[model samples]
Target chain A: MTLPKTRWRRRSAARPDEILDAALTAFIEAGFDAARMDDIAARAGISKAGVYLYFGSKEALLRALIDREIAPIATLLAGFAETGGADPEGTLHLMATVAIERLSDPRFFAVPRLIIAISGRFPDIADYYRTEIVERAIAALSSLIAKGVAQGVFRPVDPVLAVRAVVGPVLFAALWRHVLRGDTDVPPARVIEGQIDLLLNGLKP
Target chain B: MTLPKTRWRRRSAARPDEILDAALTAFIEAGFDAARMDDIAARAGISKAGVYLYFGSKEALLRALIDREIAPIATLLAGFAETGGADPEGTLHLMATVAIERLSDPRFFAVPRLIIAISGRFPDIADYYRTEIVERAIAALSSLIAKGVAQGVFRPVDPVLAVRAVVGPVLFAALWRHVLRGDTDVPPARVIEGQIDLLLNGLKP
Candidate 1:
């Protein structure tokens, strides 16, 4: 009974993740409107039926991909919270660094582009993006800003607005570099550092 | 002779402009892929062949739309340049104010959204957008930053990064208010002022 249970657990864990990985690549390249399930299965070296067994449909597959990728970002925010928000700059720096690092990882970068690429065709996906990813991120950063303000380390700024100020430029730059421009030579770390500095001192004040 | 000349001039100018306006609306709503020439012609209250007589094809119509709508943004930048780079903050403030004011004009708002929506499907359009709109804006902002740095008004920040820092938040907020969130209650001017203030002062700096 123990041997059978161990084998079942091991088999289920690896195959679904593999299918998701293939699905992400296919979705990014061909877009949701054009991507075929058969291609995803072929890329994953599995049957079309097998891919469906993991995710009931392509939409479900996208949801799963989003869920898998976003979990780590949530975890990172949680870890930042646990530190009592002692260093706002440090926390922000870490967030930027992690985001930049993860963007280089093929699985992570494909998710947002996949969302943007399909968003017009399926408006529901855009709503999912706002609720699942964008709102969560804003909430986490808002809390961090509130913590810093309470500690008297930060100014009395609207946390939501502050979070936007802190993260907006970095995210936009990353989007331009990685997705729009496809220029890999520009180091994300340098861009993050410059952005963080601008945020810290601001344009004038 | 005067009567015949006046009739021809009125026929050429008014009809084409009306057709362009209708095409802009239909393109914005339906996007390039889904927009039909017949629908545009019907919207313009002209024959389908008449629409072709002016623009030749759907692609040609889009090209004409881009020229009519986006050329003004370039003209605005050129006007700003002609004023001389005296005050960075003042110039930027003026630009923001004018941009927000122009949001009341549906053509100003809808045309860009149309381009963003359709650019992914048509690579040529995307290339034109990158080359014509985005690159020009970046160059203009970069020039402004360089001028500011030279005059000892702004810190000697990286011009590219500074432009991103200044523009990204404002653009995101505007897009959210107008396109995504549709919260027109909060005036665009107020949002622009807050963003400008944020840029001038760092969160921690």
Candidate 2:
């Protein structure tokens, strides 16, 4: 029973993640329009039928990438809420750190890159990305800023713009990594923290 | 003499510009790899020979786009130098304004988009954009920030990161306009101005 249970747990944990890793490579190499599931399965060391067992189609694979890679955005926001009341600014700082850390991770960077790369050709992909990921993250950051303004801890500023100000540099860093990566001397963390520092100091009344 | 000279001047001015516009459309539709010179020439209402007269090859056409479209970047820096001594902060503010205006122009928007879109597949294009445009702009912004910090106009900060902090948001906004068009409620001007305002305020001692 113990041996069988171990085998089952390992299989469940590894299979889906392996397929996703393969999918990122395929998508980046050939793009969404040209990436094939059969090729993805081959790269993942699985049969086409096995890939289908996990993801119904190429679209589902993309959605799962969003769900799995980007799920951190909502989770981080919710987690911060429990302790957010203790210190409004602290909550923002933590969120900034998390955003830079998560966004700059190469494993998850593909999702945003894929969305931006195809954005010009496919309006629907951009819309879905905004609805599923970007807008939700913006809403969470906006609410955090609004709370600060309401409590009189931070100066009155446009929360939406402030959220954009905070998040934009890190987002830009993430995209720039894939675009002009070797050209930049500034490390990802430095770019994120430097941008956040200036913005945070400016936020103080 | 006047009639012949006028006819020649109009043809010379219009033909190159028309070819560049058609090149932009072709690049966006098919990317750098698949885009054909013949197709671009057809779109521009010219013969392939006409295009080759102005541009030697496909690579030369792209280089011409960079020269014609992105040349403003360096020129703007030179324009700011005359008044930079009188007002360093204002210099940056004006540059920010110019950046937003220039980048948002649809004709120019496609240049950066084409650069970013194929950055992974074509490293040289990204390098060309970074070296030719980004580095020059950063140098101008960095010098301005250094002068401000030295002259007691701004709080001391890492000048490189400061320049990046200033440029990153507006650049992001320009890119965002194309990627998430029709979805944003905040006007483009507001997004760029708000982010700039926060950073400017933060720069104060």
Superposed by TM-score, candidate 2 places the C-alpha of residue A194 at a distance from the truth, in angstroms, of 3.5
What are the lDDT figures for the candidates, one per model? 0.70, 0.74
Give per-model CA RMSD.
6.3, 5.9
lDDT of 2 by residue, A62-89 (tens): 7788787787676677568446866777
The positional error of residue A204 in candidate 2, measured at the CA in angstroms, is 12
- What's model 2's lDDT at A47? 79
Q: After superposition, which runs of candidate 2 have C-alpha atoms over 4 Å from their true positions? A: A1-17, A30-38, A46-60, A81-83, A182-192, A203-205, B1-16, B29-38, B46-60, B182-187, B203-205
Q: List model 2 lDDT by residue over B108-140, tens digit each.
A: 877777666566666887788777877787778
TM-score of 1: 0.79
Q: Which CAPRI tier for candidate 2?
A: acceptable
Segments in model 1 whose C-alpha atoms lie over 4 Å from true places: A1-19, A36-58, A81-84, A103-110, A117-121, A182-185, B1-23, B30-32, B36-38, B46-62, B100-123, B178-185
- Write candidate 1's Cα lDDT for B113-152 as tens digits: 5554445456686577667766776777778778888888
Candidate 2 docking DockQ: 0.31
